[model samples]
Target: MNAEIIAVGTELLLGQIANTNAQYLSSELAQLGINVFYHTAVGDNSSRLKDVIKGAQQRSNLIIFTGGLGPTKDDLTKETVASVLSVELEHDQKALNQIEQYFQRTNRHMTENNKKQALVLKGATVFPNDNGMAPGIAYKNKDCLYLLFPGPPSELKLMFDKYGRSFLLEQLETKQFMESRVLRFFGIGESQLETEIEDLIDSQKNPTIAPLAGEGEVTLRLTAKDNSLDRVTEMLNKVEEEIQRRVGTFFYGYGTTSLHSELFKKLQEKKLTISSAESLTGGSFANELTSFNGASLVYQGSIVCYQNEVKEKLLNVSPQVIKEHGAVSFECAKQMAEQVRQTLNSDIGVSFTGVAGPAEQEGKPVGTVFIGISIKNSKTEVYTLKLSGSRNGIRNRAVKYANFYLLKLLS
Candidate 1:
C-alpha cells in the first residue's frame, strides 16, 4: 500500500496557500493502512508533473493527485495523468450535466472551457462532486492505482470521504475494516499526555495510538483493524480505558467535538439557556456556541459591548464600575455577566472582557483576559488569565477558556 500524494498547483509552489490536501490525504491513507512515503507538489507544467508521476510509479503502487481540476487552461492535472496512463479523455455525461445544472441553477452562463471539467480518463470510475463543478476520477491501470481530485479542499475532501474511500477499499480488496476513535482533550499538552501513556504507545500492536495537537487542544486517534466490528470496538475501548486511567481529567469528548459543543450539550441536559456579553472577543464567544445547529436550545443570545457606552446603554454595566475598575477588570467582567443574564432572562450568562492587542489597556498587558460566568442563584465567578499569542489568538483563546471553565463548573 505504498502511495505518493502529488499536489499539482502553481499556487501551491508560490506559497499562496498550504498543501493541506497532502496532510489530509496522508492521514486518511494511514487510517486505511496505506503507507504514504512521499509528498510532491508541482506547478501546472505537464512535463514536470509527468516526471514526478514517473518517479512515483517507479516506487509507489498508489498515486493520488490533488488540484488542477478546474475550467481554466492552467488546470492540467487530469490531462497530465491521462497522458501518463496512455489514455484519452472522454466526456462523462453525468459530470457534464452537473456542471450545466450548476450554471443554470446559479443563473450563470456556462462557458465552453468549463466543459473541460467533464472530461475524465477513459475507462475511469467517476465521482460526481456535490460541492463543485469538477469530478474526481479513479483508474486501476495494471499494478498502479490512480486517483485524481479537484484542487479546492472542500471539493477534494468531500469527494474522497464520500466516494473515493470506498472505491479504494474495494480496489485494495481490504477485508478488515479500520475503526478509529478520536479522544479529544483540553488543558493538556501533547508531550504531557503522550508521556503519561508512553508505555502503551511503545507497546502498540493491534491498536495503534497517534497523538495530534491542534489549536489549544490535543487528540489521540486510536485505530483498530478487525474483521468483526464488535472486536474493533472492544479493542479501541480497551485502549481508551487504559489511557483514561492516566489522563481522564483532561478528556472532554470524542471525534470532532469542540469544547463549546460539549458545554452546549451539558447546558441542554440541564435545560438551561445561556447568553454572553463580549468585549475584546467581540461576538466570537457567542459565535462559537451558535455554530452547531440546535444550539439555540442552550444559547439564548449575546451582546457585543465593544465600547463603554454600549456596556452601559445595552447590558446596563454601571458607569461607576467601569470608572472604578476599568472594563477589562474582573469586577467589570462579573458585573457584565450578571447584568446580561438579568437583561436577557437567560438561566446562565457568560462574559469576556480582555486586552487582546498590540497595546495594553488600563495598565494591563496584552493578552490579559477575564472570563465571567453567572448561574441563576450561584455567585458570579471570574477566571483571570494572562495568555501569550497574536491578538487574534488571544481573542480566540478567550472563547476556548470560557468553554473550559463552564464545562468544569457544570461538572
Candidate 2:
C-alpha cells in the first residue's frame, strides 16, 4: 500500500531541527513493501495542518503523522486530525492511569494539562507509550488508516515497533519479501557507469537497477521482490553478477562500504599494516581510515609533511631530488611512500602530494596531484591526476585516488 508521512513542527521549517523522522520512516516503510510517495512538513498552525491532513487522506491510503502530541496547546496534531475526520475525542482510562503512576513514581504533582495526552479518538486502538506520557493511536476510517506517533524519536520508535508495525502488516496483508544489493564503484563517473550498463538496465524486469551518485562515488541498487525469500535473493544475485561483469574492476565492497573501509578490510584480511605520508591531503586519508573501529590493527600511523624540510628530514627524501623535481613531482611522491613504509617498517605505504590552491606552486599548477603506493618487495606506482576543484575538493579527490590505487595494488 502507498503511504505518506506528515511531520508537524515549526522547528523544521525554521531550520531549528532536521527532519530525520521522515528519513527513518521512509526506510522502514520500504522494507515492508510500502511505498512512501510524499513527505510533508507543516508548522503548528491547526488550519494548515487540517488542510494537509485532508489533502493526504484523498490520495494516500495510509497516513502516518509524527509530532505535536503533547500537553501544550501548540501540540495540535491529534486535535487537527480529529477535526478533519469528524471523529470524537475521548480520554482513555488506562492511558490516564499510566501517566498518573509515572508522576507518582517521580514524586511530582500531575498538572491538568498533562491529562491531555490521555485523550484518544473514538474507536481507535490506543498504543501505550512506554517511553513518554503521550500515548499514540492507530485507527481506520472507511478505507483509510491513520497512525499518530509522538514527536520525540525515542518514544516514537518504541511505539511504532511495539504496536504500529503489526497494525499496518495486518491491514495490508504484506507477506512478500524484498531483497536489495548495493555495488559501490570509484575511479569512474556515474554517467560512464550508466552508459556501460544501459542495455542491462533497459532489459530489467523482475530485478530493477537504479544508479545513485554521491561524494566521488557511485552505487547501483538492485532490488527483487518475491514471496519466497530465497528466490528473491537468488534473483538479486543473478542481476548483480551481470552488472559486475561489465564494470567489476571499478567495483569495491558491497552495501554501505566506503573507500577507506574497503582498503582497511583488505589490510585486515591480509594481516598487513600500513602507514601514510601526507603532503597536500594533510593526513585526511589516514584520518578517514582510522575513524573506523579497531583501526589500530591495520593502520600504524601517519606523518603530515607539508614542508620540504619535513619531507627531507622525517621521510629522508634526498635534497637533490627536491631541488631538481620539486616536492609535488612524481619522484617526490614515490619517495614519500617508500620512505614512510621503510621508516615505519610497515607492510604497505601510501602517499599524497599535490598543488592544492588558487595559485600554482613550484612550477606546478593548482589541482595537479600525484598519489603513490608502495608494497614490500613490489614495484611502487604513482598515479598522476590533473583534477579540477578548490583546495579542499582537490585534497578530497586526492585521498580517494590514493585509496583506490592502494586497493588496486592490494587486490
Candidate 3:
C-alpha cells in the first residue's frame, strides 16, 4: 500500500516544532511493506488542509495525519475531515468517560468544551489513548483508509504501537513482512562498496540492497520480504554472507552497531584496558567511549594534549620529535600513544594528532591526521589520513578514525 503523511500544525511550518511524526510513521509503514511517497506539512488553515487531503486521497490509498486533535479552537482536523467525508462528528461515550476520569484524577474541573476531545467520525475505529485526552481515529472511505493520530510524540507512539498497528494488521489479507539489516563499514567509501557489489545490487529482486554514505563510514541496508520468518532469515543470511565475502575485511558490525561500541566489546572480551592521548580531537574519542555503559571495564582514561607544551610535558612527546617530524607526524603520534600506554598502565593505547582546517600547521596542510595505536608486546602503528571539511568536521573525523583503527586492531 502507498501512503502520504500530512502533518497538521502551524508550529511545524513556523519551525517552532519539527515534523518528527512523519519520520516515525514512514519508518513504521515501510516495515509493513507500505510505500510512503510524500510528507506534507500544512498549517492550521482548514481550506488548505482539505485541499492537501483531497490531493493525497487521489494519489494514495492511506492518508495519515498527525496533530490538530485538541480542545482548542485551532484544532480543526476532525472537523475538516468530517466536512470532506460528508459526515458529522459524534460524541463517543467511552472516550468522554476516559477524559472525565483523567480530569478527576488530576483534581481539575472538566469544562463542557473538553467533550470536543471525545468526538470521532460517524463510524470509525476508535483507539483508546492512555496517555492523553483525544482518542485516535481510523476510518475507511471507499478505497482509502484515513488515520488520525495525536500530535504529541509520547501519546502518538504509544497509541500507534499498542493499538493502531493491530487494526491495520487485521485489514491486511496477505502479510508480507519486511526485515532490514544494516551492515556498517569504516575505512571504506560508499561508492567503493557499492561498486564492489554493483552487479549484486543490479540483479537483486527478493532482497533489495541500498548503500548510504556518512561522514567517515558507509552502510548497506538489505531489506528482505517474506511470509515465513525462516525463509526470510535464510535469504537475508545468504545475501549478507555474499556481501561479506566480497568486502568482509572492511565490514565491522551490523544493525546500528558502531566503531566505538565494537571496539569496547572487543576490548572487554579480551580483558584489555586502554587509554588515549588526543591532540586536535581534544578527547572526543574518549568522551564517545565513556558515554557507553560498562566502559570503565576497558577504558582507562584520556589525556587531551591539544597544545605542544602539554604533548611534550604530559604525554612525554619529545621537543626534538616535534621539531624534526612536527606534532602532526607519525613520530609524534607514536610517541604519544606509547607514553600514554606506559603511564596509564594500559594494555592498549590509542592517540590522535592532526591539523584541522582553516590553517596549516608545521608545514602540513589542513586535514592532515595521524592516528596511533600501541599494544604492550607489539610495535606502535600510525595511520595517516588527508581528510576534507571544516575545522570541527576534521576533528570529528579524526576521532572517528581513531575509533575505527582501534576496532580494526582489536579484531
The 0-to-1 C-alpha lDDT of every candidate, in the order given, reads: 0.91, 0.90, 0.90
lDDT, residue 186, candidate 2: 93
Compared with the true structure, the alpha-carbon lDDT of candidate 1 equals: 0.91
CA-RMSD of model 2: 1.5
Q: Find the candidate with the highest TM-score and give its number.
A: 2
Model 1 residue 237 lDDT?
91
- Model 2 TM: 0.96
- Can you write out model 3's per-residue Cα lDDT over 10-75, one digit (the tens) per residue? 999999998889989887887786778999999999999999999998999989999999999899
Tens-digit lDDT string for candidate 2 (1-411): 889999999999999999888888887786676878999999999999988988998899999999999999999999999998899999999999999999999999999999999999999999999999989999899888999999899898888888877777888775766667889999899999999999988998878899999888899998887778889889988888888899999998789878988888889999999999999999898889999899999888898999999999999999998999999999999999999999998998889998999899998899999988899999999989999877899899899888888888888
Clashing pairs in model 2, backbone N/Cα/C closer than 3 A: none
lDDT tens digits by residue: candidate 1, 119-150: 99999999989999899999889899999999
Backbone steric clashes in candidate 1, count: 1
Model 1 deviation from native, Cα RMSD in Å: 5.6
In candidate 3, what residue range of length 10 has the lowest lDDT sum?
402-411
Better of 1 and 3 by lDDT: 1
